[model samples]
Target: MSIPTGDVPIGATVLALAEGATLTPVWANEIGGFTFRAQRADGTTRYIKYGPHNAEVSMFDEAERLSWANQYLRVPVVVQVGADHTHEWLVTEAIDGASAVDPRWIAEPRTAVTAIGRGLRRLHDALPVSECAWLWDPYSRIAGAEARGLTVPDRLRTPPSDDVLVVCHGDACAPNTLLDDAGNPIAHVDFGALGLGDRWSDIAVASMSTEWNYGPGYEDLLIEAYGVEPDRDRLAYYRDLWNAT
Candidate 1:
């Protein structure tokens, strides 16, 4: 996913959702989904995410995850979730921070990486795994991918033993973290895949994302900020699993 540029046509459904609120396109995903910030005249702000039907990403799932996560974390407040014959939309009250991959944070990798680490730890420690109704283990992920008709390597079938399991933020990439002015991570977004799984499922992805967002040499920094010595075995296994599935 990336920040949108140039003209991004607003769909009729999204326009209707805005209800006269001024709309600003904020994000565009690789799968053709778009997230817009809707600023109403009364000073309230809401976000509208719209996309064509895609099994991999579901706005309805995201809305449910956000609702469940909000009981323990700072997630967007759901306003509405609906889908048309060919598309889906989710409207949520805007959160109060910028994404970690925001240009300002991109220029300050040290702070961004550190915050991402701490924030991830907080997420793991805060969300109750036993209460979670979703699963993101390798078996589930592999099965889901296969159901989508994607080929999976046999090597990925036997994943490493579970290290500590936590409610993982399935897409723990840099862009999913939100940070405040002090560079402290305050919230996380994109929870369509959030579920019970090994903590490394998130750790490996979050650390690996550092290279894509802020270059190399910062992987360990994020791991360090999470307050644990790197488990190379688990890290490698999950990173590979992420790429394959």
Candidate 2:
């Protein structure tokens, strides 16, 4: 299920990166990237994501992260990865459901929101931070921001605390959670920035994206579904950190 954004052209040579498959353009992102759904003659379905190398959105990095995260969670399986001088692309096996922000789910915000929160909680609880290799702690994150030539504001520079940490999804927005036809979250996608961090790093962004993808008045339902009381300080700080970094 691809949402049409009229930014990039419908097709390109990158679509032919995989042999013996017919690719249909499905999605295009702001970072000059495109996602194509491919159907091979054998009835196998796969997704191909391509973007400029200079865009700083690395399919190579995502492929590595997915390989590591797959040991602990339900995510897309990496099929192949390739790169040229100007661009890089990743091919992955399709997961079983549509994004949480799919049209049907958007119309039913409660179901969508609840599944997102629960799905995120399941992801955090399932993946042990001690076993993960990457780090998404405040220092690492702020350093990443600076490396990208972005300035971190003083308020967002200081994170709440590391007393509680989990394997943060890195990009825990509503659209990243894949929901089944019954609106149950079946899997998660997009692990380019996945790492060990404070649970609020995921919680705050997942809740904030509820407002961005669905309409207002749904953030509380998400928190409730996650079975946690609101930590206002962490929520405020991580959200600011989210927008900044």
Candidate 3:
């Protein structure tokens, strides 16, 4: 059922690797990976993600994490996962809705930002910390950086006291959250970095990302929607760690 190969980018490579699929490029990430959408004979839509051989992030890892997380939350359901000699790819059923950073939401930062906070709380609470098998704590993250020949800046070496421990999203940028037209969160995407860590690890970067994606001032709105006072110390510390690591 493979579609006739054409001039498509990674679509051709992933299609060749995973039989019975014709895909069209849908999204490309900062890392040299591509996401494609495909229409199968059963009339279902699937998304395929391909990470270049040398890319730092692992698509296979993301797939495995998605599979594990699916037990507790609404993450993509894995359809197939495979790797050729040089590239790794995973295919999953597409989750509905658009990213929170979509243009329409960008114009309405209040709604988008608030939804992100509420959704993040839901994710943090939904996943039980006792059952989580992975860690993204400062110790592990620092060690990971050292192995890559990178040094954590002195300031980021120490994290502020944990406000509370909950399962973090690992990479909690605004775009990672999917929202329906009504500005309600449907599902979250991009689990490449999913792991257990200080909730602030996700909150800090998520707040910081508001500035990067929507400009300043919405960070506090997110905090309010989360139903907690801002932990300034943790926010500052994790934002530094985010850039350092």
Candidate 4:
């Protein structure tokens, strides 16, 4: 189904009733969904996200997870939730930060990479695993993708030899990391895939994004900031698995 990429119908309903509110969609991704920054007439801003057809489960799960984590993590506040868990939308308080893809970060890749690394480490260190109940395990995702008939690139379909695990952001792409005016990471978004998994799952996937978004010579910096040498074998293994599933 074609993904919706602008002001959500639900968001429109909310704004129409809200005094002097205007909604502007700021970001949209293929597999995920669209995010709208709602500027209320009161000068207050909130964010609303709606997914492509059949993405309600992911959207709703993300909202619930975000709501639970808001107690501890400096994450967005989920203000409103849809009635049904399916065919739904999520609303959150607007966060003050720019995405890593923002022009500022595009020009300052080193600082942006460092911020991502530090932010990720903080998440890994601070979030108490005992309280969370989810598994973003790659093995399950592979099976789900297959069931959905989504083509898993042959390159991304293998199991890794290393299995040291940690709580991961799951989808740690450049766009998910939010930076402040000073280029420090303030918050993270896109938690649909957040869960307990191998540390390599996060490291490999994030480092690999450098190739797609930032070009060469930056992967090493990410590894350095991650405070570990590149695990080439694990990197190759998970990347191929990610592509496939």
Candidate 4: tens digits of C-alpha lDDT, residues 149-170: 8777655555664466677778
- TM, every model: 0.98, 0.93, 0.90, 0.85
Q: Model 3: which residue pairs collide?
A: none
232: Cα error in model 3, Å = 1.4
Provide the lDDT at 192 for model 4. 71
- Model 1 CA RMSD to the hidden true structure, in angstroms: 0.9
Candidate 4 TM-score, true structure as reference: 0.85
- lDDT, residue 20, model 1: 97
RMSD, one per candidate, in order? 0.9, 2.0, 4.2, 3.5
Most accurate candidate by TM-score: 1
Q: Relative to the true structure, how large is the alpha-carbon lDDT of every model? A: 0.94, 0.84, 0.81, 0.72
In model 2, residue pairs whose N, Cα or C atoms come closer than 3 Å (at least 3 residues apart or on different chains), thus clashing, are none
Name every residue pair that clashes in candidate 4.
Answer: 20-41, 152-244, 153-244, 155-240, 156-240, 156-241, 156-244, 157-241
lDDT for model 3, on a 0 to 1 scale?
Answer: 0.81
Highest lDDT: give the candidate number.
Answer: 1
True-structure lDDT of candidate 1: 0.94
Model 3 lDDT per residue over 127-160, tens place: 8899888788887888887887888887777677
